[model samples]
Target: MKNKKFFSAEHKKYLRKTRLNRLLISLGRWSVLLFIIGLWELSAQLALIDPYITSSPSRVAKTIIAWAKDGSLWLHSWTTLYETLIAFAISIGLGSLLAILLYLFTPVRKIFEPYLVVLNSLPKIALGPLLIVWVGAGTKAIVLMGILICIIITTMSMLQSFVAIPQEKILLLKTLGANRFQVLFKLILPHAIPDFISVLKINVGMAWVGTIMGEYLVSQAGLGYLINYGGLVFNLDTVMSGIVVLCILASLMYFSVATLEHYIHKKRNL
Candidate 1:
């Protein structure tokens, strides 16, 4: 009975602490955001900063609402979202497959590893004109840009995870008469699940960056295009509104990956 009571108290304490931590995190996040918004509004109202140059939260909100009423907001947002999702899916599929191939074949890895590093290090912006010349200014160029940005990182990260797996396990599997395919499927892939999830989380942001950069170069529609147009017209509020929307969209995508990671962890634990 004493042990049962001790366990019960411990469980309650754990629950309380967890709740407190979550509350603190939420409060801190909102507090910082609110402080920044308040300061921006105050500065704008006082004319300490020109609202025309640096739009306030209110101006951004108004611009978003105006766009929404005109129906252009959804059109541009959907265009960007569609391009990003397509690129993201393709990058994950191609990257994972290529990483697996590289891991299984030493010669392939050796031949391409240096090239991957060089490509990754090269500034993507420099390739914009070439891409335009190759694919023309459209969705294809935008999607390809995002794929270029995300695929190398995914391959490098997953290849590292594959290489990091314990050699002893592979040797043991071989001793048990497990063939290469069996070892790869049952051991390497399972061990790399967490790494795959981490890559997804990171690629979400990289995909957005690439897509936005591409849109700036070639898109007739998209949040990035809106920002570019706004800048050309000196519409700071519209630019700020596009930036705000991009932030929210990126946050939502990140949280979706985090949720998937949580589900994966729960399944693995079970």
Candidate 2:
């Protein structure tokens, strides 16, 4: 009973320390962000920097407020969000499926391995004009661009995870008479969870980049469209506002993945 009590106290102390660390880390992040914003605002106010071109935080906030009041902010945000989510979903789903297929068929993997490498290395932006011409300058083209940017990466990441499974484990499963499908479901898929989470985190940024790039090339409405339009009109504040929103959205996505990772780790510990 005394030993158990001792361990219990130690565990509680460890948990408290962990929580405190996390709290301090979050505070530090916020402090840095606030410091930067405060400095930017001060610089602009002092005329040390040009607010018109550089765009102070206050001006950007006002621009966002105006957009919010006119409902254009929500409209553009939703358009970009919709495209990003679809692209994210497709990248994860189709990429994992392709990875699984490649793992299942060695000959196919060999045949497409070099091609995939080449595609992944190719600058996706170069294909923008062709995509617009082929997909006709619409949301489809935008979503496709996002998918094209991410799917290859997702496929490669997932396939690496699948292939990295220990040979001994596979042999053991086989020695126990486990077939290919059984080995995959019982061991491989489960093993890929952590890797998949990491890939999700990476794809979040890639998805946004692809979507925004598509919008820059051919978009009627989206944050990217707003930024492009604002630039054309010399509305620096509007451009900054769109960029701020994009950064916030991307940060949110990254944090969401981090939360999932934390939850999974906690649950595993439990």
Candidate 3:
């Protein structure tokens, strides 16, 4: 007890308030979710809408349970998850490398900047057919589609973050006789991290879009294919189940990134 430190009364009060605020925020989120779910189920029970077409929450859940029993859920889930993760990893790796290269070479950056801008603006969906012809109908095409959707944005976003570093900082480092590589490692890379995380959050959605689009075109497996197949047969339950599962998966990936951001923020504050 003697070795322990105690906060002032005001500090203790503030801490209590902070905890209460966090509790309230969590409660609010759950309450809203429950309210929506209750409303949906109630509507379905009353036949407010056609559950056959709209697919009620219970119907979706039942379908999901059915999939779980049959094992297709696991297979399809793994296929989509695997392709997405592969594309995500490659996009981040290749995009960051390209950004660094552009940052290090002014002439090359100047030459390619316009083309990159145009390509980034191009509708990537239009490239789906081209990708099919080039890579054949399969995971290669799907993963490439996913990569194409986000890689340019990643490169541009990261490059801007690096360039956004105040010129004064660069001059200071130069004044200290730091080389370009030293400045990059010590300053630019660290400063760009927050932006990199933001780009990651954005790319999560883009990756899903690309992968799903590819699956729509040629995939034999994955959530995207499941959804497409369901729609073709008017299997509302299956379609809704696939959609719900996709949402859950995407939410998981997004929250994972958010968790990383939170951890980084906490470490920085510490």
- Which candidate number maximizes lDDT? 2
**Candidate 2 residue spans exceeding 4 A from truth:** 1-24
TM-score, one value per model: 0.94, 0.92, 0.93
- Candidate 3 lDDT tens digits, 1-270: 573357778887898999999999999999999998788888888999888888888998999999999999999999998999888889988999999999999899999999999999999989999999999999999999999998999999999998899999999999999999999999999889899999999999989988999899999999999999999999988999999999999999999999999999899883
142: Cα error in model 3, Å: 0.7
Per-residue lDDT over 158-267 for candidate 2, one digit per residue giving the tens place of the 0 to 100 score: 99999999999999999999999999998999889999999999999999999999999999999999999999999899899999999988898899889999999898
Ranked candidates, highest TM-score first? 1, 3, 2
Which lDDT tens digits does candidate 1 get at residues 39-72?
A: 9999999999999999999999988999899998
Evaluate all candidate structures by whole-model CA lDDT and list the values in order. 0.94, 0.94, 0.93
Candidate 1 residue pairs in backbone clash: none
Ten residues in a row with the worst lDDT in model 3? 1-10
TM-score result, candidate 1: 0.94
Considering only N, C-alpha and C atoms within 3 Å, which residue pairs clash in candidate 2? none
